[model samples]
Target chain A: MVSIRDVAKAAGVSTATVARVLNGGTPVSPDRTERVLRAVQELDYVSNGVAASLSRGRTGLLGLLVSDIANPFTAQVARGLEDEAVRHGYQVLIASSDFDSEREAQVLASFARRTVDAVALLSSSGVGEGVARLIRNGIPTVFVDRRPPDLGEIPLVRTDSLSAAREAVRYLIDLGHTDLGMISGPAGMPTAAQRLAGFREACATAGLVVRPKCVREGFLGTQGGYTAMCEVLDLPVRPTAVFSFNNVLAIGALEAVRERDVRIPADLSLVTFDDTDLFPFVDPPITAIEQPAYDIGAEAGKLLFARIDGAETAGTDVVLPTRFHVRGSCDRPGR
Target chain B: MVSIRDVAKAAGVSTATVARVLNGGTPVSPDRTERVLRAVQELDYVSNGVAASLSRGRTGLLGLLVSDIANPFTAQVARGLEDEAVRHGYQVLIASSDFDSEREAQVLASFARRTVDAVALLSSSGVGEGVARLIRNGIPTVFVDRRPPDLGEIPLVRTDSLSAAREAVRYLIDLGHTDLGMISGPAGMPTAAQRLAGFREACATAGLVVRPKCVREGFLGTQGGYTAMCEVLDLPVRPTAVFSFNNVLAIGALEAVRERDVRIPADLSLVTFDDTDLFPFVDPPITAIEQPAYDIGAEAGKLLFARIDGAETAGTDVVLPTRFHVRGSCDRPGR
Candidate 1:
């Protein structure tokens, strides 16, 4: 291991000079700085984070909590967060709660114990209680993807799910489809509730009857969508078009329609919320409400740093817009 | 926040007894344990990891290095690793390198500074040069997915890429396809090289000639696969069947064929390496070589713990098998 003393001795300078160069404390002469850097490279010196943290009383780490890592949407959000965090000279410690409230609480406590400079969450469950408790105890927190119930002024980064849902529903309505159904996400999730509300609002504005039989709440994955679609398909008067609240549900609906030999845009029209890089490859290319997931993550990261830098004011909410991607899956009935 | 003294007073036990109950150090009367547990629940006591580390002289945190977090394959591997790690009373610190060697080295140095108990890597770019320094300094490490060039004896958990590729190619061959092309992964990646070797060996065994125009190398992602497929499509003598080295490439090939109006199976047969949860949902349903990614991660985790426990032996390599899933994409040349 190359110590500051070794670098100082190699460069014929004092150890304080080497320390100053490494820590960027005070400027050193260009010649001495070059010598110190050369010695560092040659010796392959790696700083000890534990020792540094002990001296500085900070870990230079940020903690992130997500509902699940297996979900591609959440994974993409994490990717954006990590990119921005690393750029800002911070590392991330990630924890997944699997949408379990107890697990979310445990992860929150763990993050606090690690003394991370700040925390971010993509919480669907009401783990905001734990987060609020942490805030009361003076830990900086920023919520992403899901807005907590009592988020009054707390910094939140999210997509405009309600408006996105309305846009998707309106697109289907424009396609000359009156009989519509929806497969929604889990009931308690704020985003899911907002999307459902948007769907109803769109139906009322268009003078289309919103039937109770058309909606089902469950997991936001393929199986959930499949089961929900089955229910809708079994109705005495089945919907001619379906708006899936998320991509997983849309995928499930596609599979369901295919299994039943229902021709897309001929017998049924479909549109999904959220788009991924892989979505374009699907046959009949899905019409989607594309959320700016990457931008949301970057914005949340910047906000978190702001809070960490003593922006003691109550955090603000940032809702990014979603774009409607018109593709082959959405078209006029009997196309 | 509840203290041990509070729990002790409520349970009518000494503080030492309360501590032992919380740490699960010794057996206590069931009645007393229940009382203490109730008190803990009522008071909402959360254990602090840093404070515990200070008392125990270890943080109980492990570091994980992944090539990319956005890659679904890597994400699945990480999920498996973390699942096993958490079960054994450890949390993971994740860092991604984006396939850059310098970033990988930086993450390695960062993990070491944190004094992580062990480190696991999903796809390491460079050989054990930088990590060898960590090993010399007494840090335990286990490589997953990819291994260093010189660290032959180091602990490694990887899928049998040779067999996986052979099976994927043989599946296409068995489907009555003769002219086949392959989209390979980036150069210098051990898994990619091994997969290519397997493909070549399978062709040689069947007395099939591999055309020079049939192979191209780049990162394993949607764009990489797409670019390679564009190159393959531009060739004067295009293959009747194609085998993509990984799922990302398979996705790219799917898109390319769609763009070119090339009908799958009827016009081109396709098979891919590494099946993910999302693979089956793609249109035409891709056939794939399914590597036991989760098992590999679990095995690597166990290996790391074994080393940490002072197994007193040289590191070992464990290679798991791959299964080929036949789907709708491959067929007889005439379809």
Candidate 2:
């Protein structure tokens, strides 16, 4: 309960001097700054961040809500966003929604309660009603990775998942994969729908009919991928090649392939999205479409700062490019 | 600029009703709550989180600072901690220090300025001076994974790295390997020091002369591990087996080994710490001492909440057990 007045009195300095020292940036004599710090420590004066931020009209804190922090793609995006946040002298508070819209709403509410200066929401799932609340509260928000239709005018920074998926599917088709299967993300996620659309588009362009049984939707996790792959393998007419929505799914599919003693590329071709470091080292070096995850995050941060700074970027959508790494995981269907 | 009074007036309700609707917990008539929310939206009444928190004397926020969020171990730990935080109606803010003590200090200072309810620091490097400032300001903190000597009387939740390292080395020795090289973490990290000590202790117990050239320090990253492994490989007499301090380093060392066309188990045996899911599927599946990363994080969260709730658990260290998974990575080395 020690106040700034006590510290100012003990330091023999004015309240302004203590505030200047604590908040930094202002020019203060080194001697006075040292004395103020010493007094703060000796008197155990804890500055009320709430009171200070209230008066200043800025908290210097950004709230980031990611779908899953454990996912490498999201994690890298977070790192990129944090790097930008730190560069701008802002502290970011991160919370994971775990792909649940309810949890996303709760997290947004919590962020609001904390009064973060602005928020960046990264979710493949649909944007929830909490977003409307945040917008109504006049908090600046930027969507990263996925921008649902409902979020009509919110600024977004993301890679073009549809085109990337089409490119990956085209690559598989070029490998003579007419009987191709796909493991997609959750049903409601925009990214999942876009990727699925791309897959069908590519198949149609090649004059090939994608069998209904060959397409499966999985949760955005390895376990989900595994179960989906198992279902595909259990089919009477197995696919000669598979394109997974993301790296985690690809890995789970790989596990199922390995478990069933199916040789990669030789028995079944494979391609996945979001290439990670492990892709290059895996037994048959996975063929992958690498999204500019870090760049997307950084751009999201940039757009968010612009919004917070009162820029007119409400409808801005900064789409970065994706790279396809042609490795040994893809080949002409041998079966 | 819209205030609670404006919202209440618009909704035909009291300011207390608006506050209750916004804050939750208090059961009010559904109609009244709906009206208040509509008025808030219509008026764009953003709640002053700082002012509310100052009056209530609690922010319901916990800050977590980890060495590296990109690392899978730390990422999982974060997920675990956040799970516990959400379960207890608290939100977590995460920051990565990137193993720099200076950055760690900056993060801590920023956390203090944000006035988080409590903090948990997970660093393998060293804790810096900002800790003292936080402690002086009456912020409760608990150390996770590594507790430096300077952090006396601070509670810790970590696995017994020394015993785990000793066990790993002994297991390698049991496979009849005499010359064992080690890739350790940073020079001054407590966990690094303990693991190195355990390596040396095991060698001493086996009556083997420890060669200085056989031990190398890595920066707790893949690139550092690669460089260190390359250096070890360039030695005049290569060891029969190698122990990497963590999975990241082991993967880096594996890359170096693969680049040189060195066969595993036949040419050299490998053991590592912190078993990740990738370890089981890698070629010649690695032998590893798996630290209970998630459990450690959960325990740390439990301890942090205990401190926040006014429990007397300071000076306590919660030591979790490490599981040894012996896979195909080790054997009688035929060098």
Clashing pairs in 2: none
To one decimal, what is the Cα RMSD in angstroms of model 1 from the true structure?
Answer: 4.4
DockQ of each: 0.44, 0.60
Taken over the whole model, the C-alpha lDDT of each candidate is: 0.78, 0.85
Worst 10 contiguous positions by lDDT, candidate 2 chain B: B123-132
Report the lDDT tens digits of candidate 2 across residue range B1-335: 67788999999999999999987999999999999989987876777777787788877788899878989889988988888998898888898887777788888886676468888888755666788777767788888888778877889998999989998898888888889999988888888889988988898899877778889998878999998899888898999889998988988898899898888889889999888766766777888999888888899889988888889887999999999999988999785
lDDT (Cα, 0-100) at A92 in candidate 1 = 82
Kindly list the per-residue Cα lDDT of model 1 for residues A122-236, writing each as its tens digit: 8768775678667754667888888677776677888888888987898788778777889989988888999999998888889999789988775866788888888888788
Span of ten consecutive residues with least summed lDDT in model 2 chain A: A106-115
DockQ of 1: 0.44
Question: How well is each residue in A1-335 modelled by candidate 2, as lDDT tens digits?
Answer: 68889999999999999999987999999999999999987886767777777788877788998878888898889888888888898878888888777888888876665478889988655766778778767788888888778887988888888988998999889878899899988888788888999999999999999999899998878999999999998899899998899988887888898899888879888899888776776778888999888888888889888887788888898999999999888889886
- Candidate 1 clash pair list: none
Off by over 4 Å in 1: A1-47, B1-48, B51-55
Candidate 1 lDDT tens digits, B109-143: 77766457788877647645668876765678888
